[model samples]
Target: MASMLEFRTPGWNPYAVKYSPYYDSRIAVATAANYGIVGNGRVFCLGLGPQGIQVEKTFDTNDAQYDLAWSEINENQLLVACGDGSIKLYDMNVNDFPIMNFHEHKREAFSVAWSPVTKDTFASSSWDGTVKIWSPARKDSIQTLPVGNCTYSTAYCPSNPSLISAVSTDSHLRLFDLRTPASAQYHLTAKIPVHVPSPAPLPQGPSPPAVPGEILTHDWNKYNHTVIATGGVDRVIRTFDIRNPSGGPASVMMGHEYAVRRLAWSPHASDILVSASYDMTVRLWTDGSTMPAQQASPVKAGIQLGIMNRHTEFATGVDWCLFGVGGWVATVGWDERVLLWDANAMLRGQA
Candidate 1:
């Protein structure tokens, strides 16, 4: 209750929010006007104060911003994934213009993530069906991996800078290891489908037709390096282990009434994650893995800890504060509001 804070973003609908790794109270948001279909966008830097959330800086862009990532090596810099198929690097200390820009994708850049282990590098996924790796010092993308489908989210392993993961419109999760040679198709090491393959001995009833949907979001477990959670149009959250794909989802949780748009695993707990959905609610969950593939029906047993439904429009983004006791989270929605609340309090019915 008391731990919650809210700020209204004027004339913009936020698509993503990220807490600064260097400062617990400093946050950045990527937002678009007219709900991203058209019109310009903006990036906002904010600070949490005793009175409320205060605007620290703002940068306006010619196109909508779909996502953003903070630089791990520089406190003043961040990268924006843009609707114009470009990535713009901005320095908070500089003027409104971006200090660096990389353009190659043929369509909108949907996601951008800073490498956790390698501070100098970052990756961006796009509607152009490709993922490109870049460094702040370089003018062009250092590497490119084609997915052949619109990629919605991308992440770097917290423990291994060489390992990367992406989820796309094909509903498949792909892992690429940069350590391997580019000749090896950019080290596309693993691929896992989002749906669960039917168990041995099909049920007695008639088999149902398959439903195709897009995977809109995914995140790597910060503590458990091999664990990956994915969500999408199916409205199911499934966890997978990169070591095994034939075994199917290690766990599955179903509660969202609409597509999940974005998600983040808690920095404090590997099994805990928070999801924002088009259904206008943000829900917390325990990934419910009973020691990997050893458990039977792990997903059926996964628990939904709590749900936050204060937003009046689609909830599009969520992030956890990495510096504190770790329950602190920030969520942004189409209602043009950013919410800061304690996840633990939501679980206790206090927020």
Candidate 2:
């Protein structure tokens, strides 16, 4: 097989791309016209073939689409977050229109994540300073958690169905344990300041003081339930231990010349992750917790393993191919291009 493949969306700029949990040959992209400023949005269902990536279906909407998630419960269904504060559920078997529309958010819906454990519920973060939990079978949200700022990203803990987490413009990472009583603060568990200064100073000198900045993207480590990675306008990615929020970042990964747009931890490797950025590049990194050098160092810092710079605009989204040997990756950007490549091949070339 070829190491790389490309597909163009023409007028639509993609914000997120997700590979199907059910099919290795299928993927979905959430896209917006005019760079999501003042035009319509679209969700494209793409199929991978011997020839290349092909569009199998498309659903259009009046608002700009920002993010999307494949339905864990149904192979034929998916959800899209939109600029007009709405979430639309689309069925590939159905034609044209969405099967259901959820419109409770008062601002742009920035991100959506389906619960990997529960499979029946999903969560959405919005610019309206809230994260709402929803079930596809209902019109209204089951519960709404107050973020108190523009919440950009939210996800259900892959290992625990009752645990939820979100990052926001306030530079804070908030965790919600649904198992907790609502009267005990809406199930809110912990709030960690993502940009705090490291407790252990560098060997060369004292560490610099931390500066709070807007956090745009984050993802939980699939293998380590307590570790979560976050990146944002600060152009640095930091991982935190939910069990010890006050201890500071478990490890810091720094390299992006521009703000990090999105990041995903590899399903196959506990230490491996890939991030897309405004710098028009996708980078692979290892949190270095498992590395011999990092284990001996006073401060743990992640190392950049490799980089992919084919995108001509902001690289907004990326995902790993779960069904394969675990190095094939799919990335989408504002350049209207989707690039699928063998990340293992890139690492081999670097080696």
Candidate 3:
């Protein structure tokens, strides 16, 4: 038995982790105290002391601030999503309030993300059931992607700047292509209920148990944008080749004992996969399509490391990050702590 995680550095002892072009570590995170700085995802938890959750010194997303996004082009600029249907732009260097407040959504924005390929392009989805593309240069969104139900979360396609996908509270997954003349209107590419049939135990143990057919949420792979990996309420991680909408899953990865909340690929290692679930464990899987490892044992497949991943709360989001030098995985949760899982060390036992 070997450990999958090891400490590269203990920079910040904070609650959330985010990277922006403006900061030194390119990391800006939220804590119970002041916003902390990092040179490269490396943080130093600098705070006076702990205070009550209601204390003035305790850092919380007050009415003034809600969800936030780091600008891709302008490292110093931060976009904060407010409860008042407004997105505020903040400049860290001056410590001034928002420079621009874009109030477009009728309801509170649930999540905000920047396009990796498109400069000045960002997307936002709201509890109002719509996803809109925005550019600070213009007050109005060039395209408003319509969603069938209230979108829970969204991620822009990695390979294509215009392709985006989102999940709705109705438990349906929608994919959008921002190429049509009427790009504002989104088409329902695929929709399925997030449920799976109970499996009958096989002689071998129990064939890979039956699971839900529809995806819960999806993330565009950092290495290959055309490839999308989704985790669901069914407890399965399904990867799709969005390049060919007709193409089926490259493979279905099963490991988690409960509904999965997050899935991400290693930034440096394209073949490695990490997932988090409500079961309170994060499993690491290696792509085994063409190796002896692929057939070592069918009953035990895909997963290589079933780490007892500890978290303050259930894990919700996971991202690959490079802090100072090596690769690390950042996780967010209901508990509000942004944990750094040393991904490089997960494969230390590899022969």
Q: Write down the lDDT of every candidate, Cα atoms only.
A: 0.87, 0.92, 0.56
Q: Give each model a TM-score.
A: 0.94, 0.96, 0.72
Candidate that would win on TM-score: 2
Checking candidate 1 for backbone clashes, the offending pairs are 252-299
237-274, model 1: which lDDT tens digit per residue? 87888888766776677789999999889999878999
TM-score computed on alpha carbons, candidate 1: 0.94
Judged by whole-model lDDT over C-alpha atoms, candidate 3 comes out at 0.56
Error of 2 at 263 (Å): 0.4
Clashes of each: 1, 0, 12
Better of 1 and 2 by lDDT: 2
Per-residue error at 219 for model 3, in Å? 1.1
> For model 3, how many clashes?
12
Cα deviation at 49, candidate 2, in Å, is 0.9
Angstrom error at residue 101, model 2: 0.8
